[model samples]
Target: MHKLLLVMVLAAFALPARAADPLPRATPESVGLSPERLARIGAMVETEVREGRIPGAVVAIARRGKLAYFEAHGFQDGGRSKPMPRDAIFPIASMTKVLTGATLMSVLEEGRLSLWDPVSRFFPAFAEMRVVADGNPDSTVPAARPIRVIDLARHTSGIVYGNRGTTPAHQLWQRSLGGYSRMSGGDFIAAMAKLPLLHQPGTTWEYGLSIDVLGLVIEERTDKSLGEAMAERILRPLGMQDTGFVVPEGQRGRYATPLPKDPVSGQPQDVRVGLVTPGFEGGGGQAVSTAADYIRFAQMLLNGGTLDGKRVLSRKSVEEMTRDHLSPEIANNVTLTEPQLTNFGFGITVAVRREGGSDVLGSPGMFSWNGAYGTSMWVDPKEELAVVFMASTPGLIRQHYRRVVNALVYGAIAD
Candidate 1:
């Protein structure tokens, strides 16, 4: 009689599920992610939380097609103005390159563009390119080779952000006050054409407006704007609802504030709203996304360009997109020499699986990149893992979050 009563009591409490714990499997034990390790990651990042280095941050990691861990720390704004939510929107800065690269790869699959095709073939301005001789501002020499789409993808096209020493190209941009940093499509192409090339094509790796220029090339070939092409080819296909150059009116509330180092002024908030002009030309720097939204895109790449039954790229194309395309000699200049980092692949930065570089359990062929506004992500195909870290602050502050998160996520992989 006593045993039967106990069974009935358990059934009564379990069957009438309360809203508090409706889904038991959503818990760590049911999903297989070690809660202890997840807590450790939170604790590590919390150190920054206490120091007030950032207003807030969101970190999400996925393994084997499942969300292994998702957590938020700190406030979405300073003074604990708003609690950080998991679905908060971030500008995603140059992390836009990954999506832009994916769009190019899809176009390549459709035979609209070839990696080796010279940019001049599509844009006449690239026809008479010249390299800045001896780093001289006025000196110029003809390019030994043509600028190829592949070179742009790998950032080996000799294009750099700021020439730093008043080179011809640099002076022209400064003189014109041209917005190469944010320019897109035809105008962007025109501005680049008027300026001199920084170096011979494929001669060195420098991070600059290469991807933005590639966005123009896509526009020229497709005859449609970069926004439309990316929407039809990449965003819609991935079901990345929140991923776009502009945020919808109703969804604008989800976007987080972007600080400009003034803790009290609160001057430039919500970087996505008024700063980035919404159009086809902003593809390289205009994207806004949430952690959940980007994870789907990353997972698609991990799953051979298909996610949730949506196919975006062929297996061969995916492999080609992630492979390192730079020559070994030029790869050394890809990242800052002080960082002493890895090489650059076609559209993504490659981590050469060094034994001592990062103790994380990433695959030898892992490739990923970050945005200028503190958004960083990486895909380790060999390990079948994808991690996306999104935040709203700018500059090298992202380096700390990138390192700490990777250490915690990869360390808990249960190798």
Candidate 2:
């Protein structure tokens, strides 16, 4: 009898304790945030929707590894008929760069490539690149040096989106866009090589197609498409099941929609229809994700590059990626049309606090980035916090939404 009792006791002792939920929920007060203040975030978003500024939004906040608040406001379309679900998928756009950055860091951790490696190492044509002078594509000078891999990650590669400004490089970029959607990764790189750079590599910070080039680099290094590489390295491991370059037909119901027309421009808002599958998956943009999925990604970074005991990157790699990689000269030269008061990191934006005044609110060392659509996220190491704000408004109004969300989220911190 004693033997039987001993056996039962041993079996009970050997049983594992209940595993914690993958994303545990908690109250704002329990997480050192105020419930009343956090509600203001919803209130503000609600007002924006009521006023017809944005169609709808999903705002999520997590602190100290616990989800404190997550709410959806307004409708998925301008008609105010279809309600927005908390899990509605929105086009993450440029926010895809950070995921690409993380995927590249995973490759870097494997010693497959170095940040200092020249772009010519993968594409030899980048070695003999030229620079256009004074908005004149006709008057060009030989590039002093090859564009480095780091230059692409940090937007220092002098590659600009032709659609952005009116410059020689801009015009060249505009011309290149005509066939951008049809080109393979190799063809895209070849086309970019033929165009003169806007500036010498590592000299200036021009937000452009640099990350897209980095995406091609990943494909060259891994012998896989960018989407495939990211899935193997980032999405699957992070359990971001809903995030990808394409939303399947069955999942299309969850896709968010923007207003029929741009609120400001009064033109039809260019909405992404169907799957965004391309010959080469763009690292610059063209990805869709949900707030829940992205907050997990953000939490992984906030937790020092690991989440749920899975190590995506080393703490050192996270630090290097998030720290301001821009030189003072380059930073000073940054003239963003948006109201972001921040500096560029490798693939994210680092919010630096000025002594006298600033446009946005939050602690310094806050690392973040936003999509061209109304999607923004930030990981505040100081506050031990992360926030993901997702919407589908595709216009300059996104900047205002980002700013308002930032201010309201910061103000909600009772602690």
Candidate 3:
């Protein structure tokens, strides 16, 4: 019986991956993972839910190109309603940047775009930009350099998230936020042009509107919306059907919401924007997806840009994306990154772990990104592993779960 089951599982993995249904399933042992260790993931999550640390969560782990562990814990509403479903959608936030990166790289593969190309090449508004002088928003100077396409991908561009600052520059950028939910690509660029950048182009690794500007570039090049272009190039090809800027009308019930309030402070937590985005397709955030849909994306990266014989990008492109594009000479490349990714370097829309410096256990080349609304995923090439953790904790609780999955998942690896 054991031989027969193993044979069937291995055979199923041989088939091409499909989107409409779950990926081929396999026992954790079949993939060289300890079943006992893998169960710890569910136990930890359930304890978190019972203790009011989180509402619910859906975790999916893939190994050897097969689904070795997939589980949902708690319910959509504090364990009152239906238990979280495997297909429940979560707003992936900045995880959306990777899809945009993949889409843009696909364009680069066609030789139509170059990382070195200046943003002004596509949007004339950026032809000349300014940099804030000595922390003074009112005093500015002409940009020392042009914002290149690569700067946007690695987030070295001077732009920043308006909400992250209080200076006049950030406030200037903040005023544009209310309109993003309905703004268009051309309008977004025009709005950004009037604001002073926080750093010179390619000077600092501050997280900001770099990808949003690149989204406009995508629209200009494809004559389609950012979501549409991504769908045609990467999402559709990889069978990420549940990923987009908004949930389908029918899938609204499957969307996860953060707790009504922070567990500690008891302050109301309204994160409606965390799950569903309407209007402008901000590449930096404002995106939604499901664990099932996103794991295929991670697997594609692990598979070196192809899955089930369908090639979305070349291996060279994926390698370039996962490598540390920053040189040691770039002063703020490692330190200035928002949230300070310990022992990690900024990759193309992802974080690349260096050889040492992180307290966590993982390979040196592992690449990952997480959303603000309690979603995280990482692909470790050395382990042939991809893990996607979904939840709507939206506070410090989200960070706790991220570490939980990282340690437990890696600990479960037996081979």
Candidate 4:
């Protein structure tokens, strides 16, 4: 009986391991990513979870308005109490710029505001704006050119975040708590007017708080708060139900906790960065959303302005918005200098796609951006793909989440 059992076990082992579990199918050969490829993506994400780099993540892929792949991994909190859900909400940081940009596009569509409108025309304090000189706090500068709505969108309006390096504008920004800390967009604009421009408008590319200024421009033109205007123009139409600055009382717990690195110990620390507060309403950083919410926003772009019968923009406007509107120098600076991580194309970061360039996947014109906490999404129109990865930790960016996503998504495409 023992000999017979051993022979049976050997025969089972020789049966070729059951083909390693068939890969999941996602789409037809002519469509987007294949199921086998998406399965590989699932495997890669699972490996990351097992390795403990990301505590939890929600990844989804949409091709031609269809959710080809949607999977969640890990936990919502570090304690592994709640599984990460597909609709988990995250702060989505600067990714809000795309929505802000879309709102600006809508304003342009309505003829209420023009991209070339001088910011000083609406806000007089910017009329006599000056740049920092010789590190002098009160140095006066001859106005080179008036800053415009386009300048803010392109990040050439000469503003700084006040923490990266020091300049006169940085100092003024530091001194102007009403702008930086006040949660109101109107108050922030008032504070911005108190400070001086860092450079002549439209001449240089500086990644500062210029978009927040654009939010003020939108509010002033519409007579509505930024949130209200966005809801009416973009959010509600796109069905981005969970994307906004303020989380309602019952939904407060749905917001993901930001895992900021501790300054003293250099370890991951749970810092509950609330979605709604008195301070972050107007800046480009206020919008909080889920991966699904942002994917819908991206799909609108991918579909050339309308998704699910909601016409957020026209194809012409989407084309213009995604096109490089900056001077060659500014584009180069965006790619090579400032952020030094990616290129910028009017409100969103455009990934450079030269064969040997900074980008490792797809062709030119791939555009995307990430939030402060590790939520990232990119749309590759050339490849007809949109990949999103959302995590509640700040350190996930440096962990190659994007690299893995790109690799798996492309790898899964069946020939």
Candidate 5:
């Protein structure tokens, strides 16, 4: 059958990208964490796998600039025949935003862009934007201010994603934007410009196509693909060898896959991304990376944008990126609906906890973010900690593990 041959052809190109060298290992206590308390994570993740919540997961933590806990739980596939590799590649969806944001900072350092630079500066299509008016699908109001580079970083751009909710505005986005993986950089921008925004630009802390637009900005400003700009600005500089827009030809064997059907939602969940190349690299959530490589990226942020003397960003830029960019009047959407995010605020492509109001256990100033496909990483400057969680599960459990991992890791803090 044609379908069968297509599968075979795709598999032929799917084949092995190994992770970069693992971070230096140390006993949990050496990094001021309790070995016994950290073992609780193993028990918790095992239960998650046994319950069929996830095909597999990888948890890696670095504190005091040393790797303390590196673990892989469950099997690589639904069949459970093969063990999950600690360095298994995963579709680190939204986690790619931080990389894109950081790359844009490199462009910023070179004066190609500025935080206040309007999106229309790079792509004029972003200028004549409209917002849904009177809560009506057919209504429109011009954005009070142009969506800026900073707005995109902090997700206040008001450009909404099509996947969530069935509101008229959401439907408009869904109907207008299709086949994104097939769109060129310019095509993607043109499609987005055609859709009305969910909120007035800079008025709402919305999580949506803002970063994806930033991706196009990166590609345009650097005159290279988003993937190439990211490699030059963050991946290569940080020595994140295994992270990229496409999983190399022979590296498909290392790609972790999701369950055939969601155990909870029962929808077919096929999150094995990064097989073929997209027409334009998506910053919203398209990169595949391993636990080892992703943690390195997180560690770089924790180290104030440098790792082992490789300066991916200046210290002050990292500070600004991690700080809370939202004011109290800014209405938070989608992510803020969660009780755990009550004490949090949006930052450049990540979330920053203002204080300790959430149910989750973490330091007061921890900055973190997760992917739709069950990947999460956080940097706690106060704790000198960076933790990366990679998995193939999606849906409700993605945020669930955000709480679970933070509790498990912070609970193990011995000092």
Candidate 6:
């Protein structure tokens, strides 16, 4: 009898305690946010929808590890009949860089690669890359240094986007666009190697295809496709079931869509939906996610790289990823052409507060990034907060929603 009692007691102690919920919902006041102020967020979004600016939106805010606010406004499709669902999936374009960054950090944790490793180490063709100066293809000069993995992570590799401008680099990228979406990772790297970099590596900060190159590096190091690697390293661990390169058939109804024609220009916007499995997974901007799913990703970082006891990255790695990695000149040399009032971090945009008037509202240490298709996310370590805004518009109008959301979120702080 004593042996049976002892066995039962040990078994009881051995049973794992119930795990804390990954994200617990709470009232706004319970999380130090005023419900009245948070209502303004929904109002602003509804106003935009009413004015025919955006088709729909999903906004969510979490403070001190509690979901204080969440709302779905407007319609999921271009038509106003179908109400937008809170679980609506968005084409989280460049926001994929954040996931790409986290995946690379996971690789770093496993000792598969180092930040200072040169791009040529994984793909030898990058060793022969050249730089184009004075917007002349014929005026190419050898890069001063090989593009390092850190250079790619921080956007200093001088790999500008294809549609940037009429520069020689941009023209080359535009010419190479044919193979961008269809080519394999290896082929894409080879094509990228043939084009000239916009500037010398590790010198200037120009947002471009750097993350895409890093994605290929991750594949080479892990012997897995980007989607496969991300699933194993991030999505599965974090339980972000709704985020991936392609949405399943059943989830197609929740995919958000913007107006076919621009409300202002009446020009047909190029809004591409990723319903089918992609042949090539571009790490730069080819992923879709819902607001709830992305908030879990952001919350993991805000919780010091662990969500519900699943450690995706070390706390030290999260700090390194979020800290400002730009040089003084690059951070201060703001021009009309470059990103204003912000600094670049590893795969994310770090918001910096200037002394005078600023373009957005947030804490100085807050780090965030957005997608071309009207998705925005930010993590404020100071406030222990994470906010996600999702829509489908793919133009400059998304900027207005960003500003309004930022104001409403910060303005709702009650304590």
Cα lDDT of all candidates, in order?
Answer: 0.70, 0.81, 0.82, 0.67, 0.83, 0.81
What would the per-residue lDDT of candidate 2 be over residues 129-219, giving only the tens digit for each residue?
A: 9998877888899988789988888888888888888866687778986557568877888898899988988888788888889988898
TM-score, candidate 3, is 0.92
Clash count, one per candidate: 1, 0, 0, 6, 7, 0
Cα lDDT of candidate 5 equals 0.83
Model 6: number of clashes?
A: 0
Taking the tens digit of each residue's C-alpha lDDT, what string does model 5 give over 85-124? 8878888999998888888888888988899999899989
**Residue 247 in candidate 2, Cα distance off native in Å:** 0.5
TM-score of predicted structure 5:
0.92
User: Can you write out model 1's per-residue Cα lDDT over 1-415, one digit (the tens) per residue?
Assistant: 9999998865543323223210111334333457787788777756766766677778777766766666677777645578888878888877787888888988898888789999999989888887788767477888898999988887788776663435556666566524554443566677677666677788677767788778878887788877788889988887677887777778776677754463334344345532346534554566788887788888888888887676888888888888767665664454562142443334442323332443344666787777767788888877777888887766456666676777787767654
How do the residues 92-192 of candidate 3 rate in per-residue lDDT, one tens digit apiece?
87888888888888888988889999989998888889999988878999999899999999888888888877878788778875466577666778888
2 or 3: which has the higher TM-score? 3
How does model 1 fare in lDDT? 0.70
- Model 6 TM-score, all chains together: 0.91
- In candidate 5, which residue ranges exceed 4 Å CA deviation? 1-21, 334-339
**Candidate 6 lDDT by residue in tens digits, 1-415:** 9999998865553323223223677777767899999999888878888999899899878888877776789999987779998888899998898999999999999999999999999999999889997878778999999999998888888788888677766887888964477777777887888888888888887777888888889999999999999999999999998888888899888888888887777888866657766657878889999888899999999998998878999999988888777756653333222243443233333333433445666665677888888899988888889999999988778777787788889999999
Pairs clashing within candidate 1: 95-371
Superposed by TM-score, candidate 3 places the C-alpha of residue 244 at a distance from the truth, in angstroms, of: 1.2
